[model samples]
Every structure is written in structure tokens, then in C-alpha cells.
Target: MQRDQGVPQPRLLHIEADYSPAVSKTEPWVDLRSIRIDEYLQARSLAVKTQKAYRQDLQHFLRWTDKAWSAVTARQIAQFKTHLVRKEEGQRVLSDATVKRILGTMKAFYGWLWRCGYVDRDPTIEVQLPKLAEPEADNLSDEQVEKILAAVAGTKLCDRNLALFAVLQHGIRAEAATLLNVGDFDGQRLWVRQDKGGSKGVVPLDEEGVQKIQAYLGWRMSQGEVLLPESPLFVSASRRNRGARIGYDTIDKLVCQLRDITGIDFHAHQFRHTYATNLVLDGMNPYHVMTLTRHKSVQSFRRYTKAADQQAAEAAFYETKRRKRKTEPGSEQ
Candidate 1:
């Protein structure tokens, strides 16, 4: 598969199987005696994570039915959903979104099985997915962002913190930022590899960005350590002695700390929103912003470009008008 700059493509699995005998069955119900998940995933070209999730969901459904999938009816699927709502432990009932995901997985698996001739019928065909409630968009204000940055300033982990800030301010995704390594950065531009969907992209380093990074690199070099080309740019201090890259969990914790310090109840994704919102507020076109963010769809980008504060919007509007008025001959004092 062709990859764009800075975007990581989903892993592809080639499927090779012949199910002609199974597809020829005209029976309403076919036996699922030896349907292995690994074989199913291999046949469907599904990602490994997706394969695991679907198999787990299928296992739960099978355990509930206490019979082979060929013997399970649509009614049993409904019963399993009810069981998930009532008898499940941990946080009580599962959220509608979670339940819908499980249902989707089941539907896809059954549909594939039926299509492949492993099953004569898809029992989950009529199962309706639950309605999902849209979540309110969470974002940080400029003041909040400033506070978070200030809190990180003069800290022992200043370099890593600044790198994280650069990602947030520049609207880069956490995954993309995490994949950054020492060699990807030249003096002029930062080469982001396989960021989203295996797309490679380049981010030009502005003067400020360059200076900040240079300062960090100078400090790093003073320690007389040689960083490998494949080594992570932002490594964990705890594992510095061991020369290990920082994991996703550490990044998540740092985000939470920033949120607490700034008193902003937001996730790491909110930084992307904050960046996009600021750009739109500055009169940048949505399409151009999408290019910088590398969003595949406009609708997805729109969600992040939410309206800024009413006061800030009005203030900016008046400020632009004031500047325009000053440029006019009669309007100038």
C-alpha cells in the first residue's frame, strides 16, 4: 500500500481461502464446528486488534448462547444485549456506544461467515445497534494553554514537555508525535513518518520551533550521549538509563498532569481542537487547516473547529474593524 508522508497505514493481511463447498449449502443453518478466529481473520484481511476484539465478542456471545453459532437465533442475540445491560459487572451497564460496537462486530463477523460459506445464515442481520449519544466537545482556552505551558517551564522534564507542547500547538496527533525520532528532524524541516494511515508528511520548523528544539538538543548533547537514528526523540526520564523509548501510557499521564495544572478538564485530543479553533479564529480556511491536520474528511475536521468563546470572537471582529478604519483617510484621528 502507498503511504503518504507522516501517516501510518493500517496493516494489511492477504486473505487466501476457497469456500465453494460451504457457499453451495442451501440449508438455513450450517454447522460452525471448527471455525477458528485466526483462520477467520486471515480470510477477512482484518487488523490483528480488530480480529482480537471480534473474537472476544464472539466468544461472549457463544458463551451466552451455550451452543454453536449455527444453532443460535436472532432472539439469543437480543438476550445477550439485555444481559450486558443488567448482569455485567464493572461500571454497571455498558455504555450504548460500547454495546453498539459489540453489535457491529457481531454483525460483521456473522455476515462474513455467511458470505464465506462457513455459515448458511447470518443471525445478526436483524439486530439493531443502539443509538449512541454524541459527546460534547472538550477544549482548552488560550489562558488554559498558557497556564499548562507555564507549569511545565523550568521543570526537570522541560525538553519532553516542550515537544509535547509543540505537538499540541501545531495540531499534531499523539500517535504522530510519538513516532518522531532523532533523524526525522533536519535543520529545516521535521519529517513525520507514517503519521495517520501510513501517510508521510513534512512540517517546516519555524524560527521559534527551531530555536526551542536546538536548545533542547544542545542540552542533550552536553550529556555526551549519542542518540540512534531510530531512537525516540522524546524518551522517558525514568528509562533514560536503560535507553528505552517512552510509552503511550507516559504521554497519557503527562497530558493528565497538564490538565490538572491548568484546571482544564480535557483529554490530549483537545489540544488538536484548541489548535484548530485558534487557526479558524485567525481567519484561516477550514480546508487549509485540514491539510495541516491531515484529516481525511471535512466533517471530521469541523468537529474540532468548534466556535471559540463569544467574547473572544467579538473582540477579534472589532479589532479587525478598528484596524481597517484606521487605514481609511477620514476614519483616522
Candidate 2:
């Protein structure tokens, strides 16, 4: 009786395999404590949310199959995907996109196992990922962006807000913003060390961006606060967490605060989308823009190009028909 190893199992749910689970209760032969999940997560340098999602998705699969990671087969992985897609009452199910994500995670899991010598073969190779619709790129307009900026101007954290948003509008993510340090900025390049989905890189800053940051730092120093190279770029000014590094929740609250003040509802991530969309609108090659956006995958990058394409086509058609007339939505009737 060989002990199942590789990914550590939590507890026995129901063995979906033809054979029964190993009779050994202690499972002394099994390397349960040595589960490579933490190691794999750290190696990937995944974002906190992504790490959580990967853990959850993997756990769900393990709970369903109730088999050792070594025993999972390509066929069984496919079966699990099928189980996710076919919605049944009182049963675990997922959307097509979600099913695709789960299978992709599984593929990564098994690929790691094979590379690390834990498995002779990758079980996820033959398991097909479910097709999902191309994700639509969402963005705010120039005017809406300006409105948000204005809304943040009157706030007590105006200097910080201006500098933070200046960076965000250039393609940095919210999570990456929190990870930024004073040393990461050198007046020209903003080095984002911790990007979402692990896409870390240096983002170039324009003259205005440099000024915004300089003003923020100047303001920090003006208030008798010492700015160090190791200091967090953004710190909370609230009574409870003053002088402390801001968290992801703080970013979310900032978005809500801006939306409420400006009466323009929007998401924090839209800053990156807006940056990408505007570049595509300016006739940048989709492939080239990824270098600026630091996108790791072309599939996700397609949304920017597609959205820009649609908008350009519509504008061109309307301009031709109206002879420089702007068409409003639902005015065709």
C-alpha cells in the first residue's frame, strides 16, 4: 500500500475513487505536514487575494475528490470540471468563468508537482479548460476622472490623494500602491514591487506625476514628519492608524469616498483600465501597451484593445453620418 503524497490533504470527505482510502488513520507514511501549498504560494509570489483564491479553489477540489494529490488523474480532473459546470440543486457548482479559473489553478498545481519530482506525470495536461466569454474592459471617461480628482482635492489628505491617484492613473494597481516605498520612486520611474497576480515592474512617470509625488513628500516633511527611504509611500492619517502604512481596505474606502463626494460611482481598478483604454484609444498597439501596463497575459490585455476598437468604430461611423456631430446613446431612434 503506497502512501498518497504531494499536496497535503485536510480530512477525508468522501472517496470518489473506486478504491477505498488508505486504512491507516495516522497516515504515518503520508507527508501531511510537509504539504507544499505554502511553498508553492510563496514561490509564485501571488498577491494576497490571489493566494486566498488559489487556496480556496484547490481546497474545494480536494474536498470533492477526497483523494490524495498523487492519485488525482487527468480523467478525474476533467470529471471535477464537469461537476462544476453542470448546475444541480443542493450541490456545489460554479460559473463557466469560475470553472475555467479552478481548472487553471489545478493545472498550475499539478505542473508544480511534476516539476518538483512529486509526480511522474501531470494530470491536468489532458483536462480541458472551459471556454469563457472575453472579459469586457471597463473604464471611466476623462471628464469622470477629472471629477474624481477634483473630489479628492478638498479632502484633508489632498496631497497624498493627489500623489496616490497620479500613480494609480498611470496603470499601478491598488494593492501595488500599498506596497510602494519612498525608495521605489526616483522622480522618473515608479518601481512597483508587489503587483496583483505577480506582475511587478517599473512604471514610468510623466512630469505631472513627478510633481505630484514631490508635493506629497514636501507636505509630509513640512508637517515635521521625517520621510525616509524605507518609509511607506502612503500612510494612514486617521486617528486610529495615523502614521501607519495603509491597507487594502483603506484604498477601498478612498474609492468610496471619492465616489460619494463626486457622486460618480466607480471602482479602484478602473484607474488601470482607464490608463489602458486611453492608450489603446490613442492608437497604441495592444502588444506594445502591455509593456507599459505590465500585463503578464495577452488574453487579459485584449479587453483594452477590444473596447478601444469598438469605441473608435462607433465614433468614426457617427462622425461620418453626422458630419462632426456627436451621437448620444439611444438617439438612433
Candidate 3:
């Protein structure tokens, strides 16, 4: 009998392969841990939440298929997708959008595996993504925004709250707000470095905004804390002992705090919506508003432009007509 090098004995092979001809001596199975998902995601510079989501989705894909990931075929992937869409006990059927997200995770995993020499080719290249329904944007009323700002004004957390409000009022995203530094501001313009879609732009700062920031900076200087060029514009007082930078969580907490104080059920993104809605209501071109907000798609911004409330619209219409009548000759003053 001829012996195969680096191969298990016949008894071991039979048990390992489950006596299937497809699992031959020529092909070896690779385990999931060999892929190092964390390292791969880090190398790609994926966001923290993205890394977590991809790992979870890939784990689900692997657990569904008992075989090693490298041994999974395109047919098996299609079947797994079918399983996701079919409702069964202990198996929650995912929506089309969710299935697409899982497929994307699988594609990225396979692509990374191939690039790392763990696999020869990606099997998920042909997988299709599902179309997602556009969600309506969440916005707050002008009164609600004013209430939140006013609440911030009367708090000990004034500086941080002011910065957060500024970002919302200006329609900037959290990522852009987090990147802001002391040096990004000239006397007149705020230079947003690599904002949404990696585009740099300048937003003019109103006199009041400038004065508020100056006052905050002055207060910091009086306390013997000078903001360097590299210092974040909004630093957490709690983090002073930790030597860590102020993160998005701090900003989120401040927003929540303001909401609690003002009795407004609003999140940080609602601020951006309020800003965009106000601009559109004031007769600013949607395109110009888009430039200010740096929205990648016009459709994304359109969701923020709420249909004018019927009562408000009627009031404005009657008010305009009344003004016109009064302005005419021989009309009531």
C-alpha cells in the first residue's frame, strides 16, 4: 500500500471527512481563526462599528454552514441566503436589506481572505445587494431647537453644549464635528477638514458664534488651559484625568443631557435636520443647503425638507394676502 505524506491515516480521514469523496486528501480545510478577522478589518481601516458588524455577520454565515469557510461553495452561499429569507423556528428570517448587508460582509471577508493568500479566489463576487427604502429624516421644530439651546445656555456644561449646538445648527455630522480642532477656525471662517465624502470646505461663522467661541477660549485660558493647534475644539472635562481624547460618546451624552433638561426628545442628528429644514423654509436653494451640509446625495437631504405644516402654510398665505390688501391704495391701514 502506498502512503500519502502529510495525510491522516485512513481511519482518521474517514471520520474527519465524514466519508465524503468531495473532502479528499488533495484539499485541506482551514479554520476561521486562521483568517484573523480583527487584523484584516484594522488593515482596511474599517470603522469600529463596521468591524463589529462584519465580524458578527460573518460568524452567522459560518455557523449556518457546518463546513470550513474555505470549503463553502457559491451554491452553499446562495442556499444560506435562502435560509435567511425563510422563516423557521430559532431562525429569524432577515429582510432583503439585512440579507444584502450579510452578503456584503461575506464578500468583504472572502476578498480579504483571498488577498491574504488564504484563498485563491473570492466566491462572493457575484452576490447581489438588495435595494433599501429611503427612511424619512428626523427633525425638530425651531421652538424645540431654541429650547435645547436655551437649556444649554443655563448649564455648567455651557462650552461643550455650545460646540455641540454649533455643529447641529451648521448641519455638520458627528464625524466632522469630532475632527474639528482649535486651529480650524480663522476669525471669519470655519475650515472643515475632510468633511463628508472627503471634501474640504469653509463655513462662515456668524458674529455671535465667533463671540461665543472666543468667550469659551478666554475661560479656558483663564483656567491655565491653552488649546493648542492639535487640541480638539471640544474637550471633555471628565477626560482630563484619563489622558484620552474626547470621543463621540461625550457629545452624545451632552445631547441627551440637553434633551432631559428641555423635555425635548431629540438626538444629535435631529439638530442637522432642524438646520437644513430652517434653511429650506427660509427660501435657500436646496443645492446651496447641500453644499453647507456636505450631503453626498440630494435624496438624503430631501428627507430633511418636511412638507410644510398645513396650519402654518394657511396662516402664512392669509397673512401675505392681508399685507397686500393693506398696502393697496384706499385699503385699511
| Alpha carbon lDDT of each predicted model | 0.71, 0.85, 0.73
Residue 329, model 3: lDDT of: 100
Per-residue accuracy of model 3 over 1-333 as CA lDDT, tens digit each: 878788966653343546545744666776656366666776775555556777888787767866765677888888877776787776657878788888888887888788888777677877677778766667787688778889888877687667557755777767677778889877676778845446567777667777777777677778788678877776667645432356778778777887778888878877777777777777777788778777778776767565433435888999999999999999977
Residue pairs clashing, model 3? none
Off by over 4 Å in 2: 1-34, 88-93, 310-333
- Expressed as tens digits, the lDDT of each residue in 1-333 for candidate 2 is 776887686896885666756676663464452377667787786778899999887876867766777887878887887777786786646777888888888889889988988789888898778777888888998899988998888887899999999988998988889989999999898988788776778889989899999999999899999988899999999899999999889889888888778988899899999999888888888887898899988888988998778888998987798853446565654
Least well predicted 10-residue stretch by lDDT in candidate 1? 30-39
Candidate 3 off by > 4 Å: 1-36, 43-45, 66-70, 83-97, 108-122, 194-201, 239-244, 305-333
Q: Give the lowest summed-lDDT range of ten residues in model 2.
A: 25-34
Error of 1 at 292 (Å): 3.0
Evaluate residue 60 in candidate 1 and report its C-alpha lDDT on the 0 to 100 scale.
64
TM-score for each of the candidates: 0.66, 0.79, 0.69
Name the better of 1 and 2 by lDDT.
Answer: 2
Q: Compared to the true structure, candidate 3 yields what TM-score?
A: 0.69
What's model 2's TM-score? 0.79
In lDDT terms, how accurate is model 3? 0.73
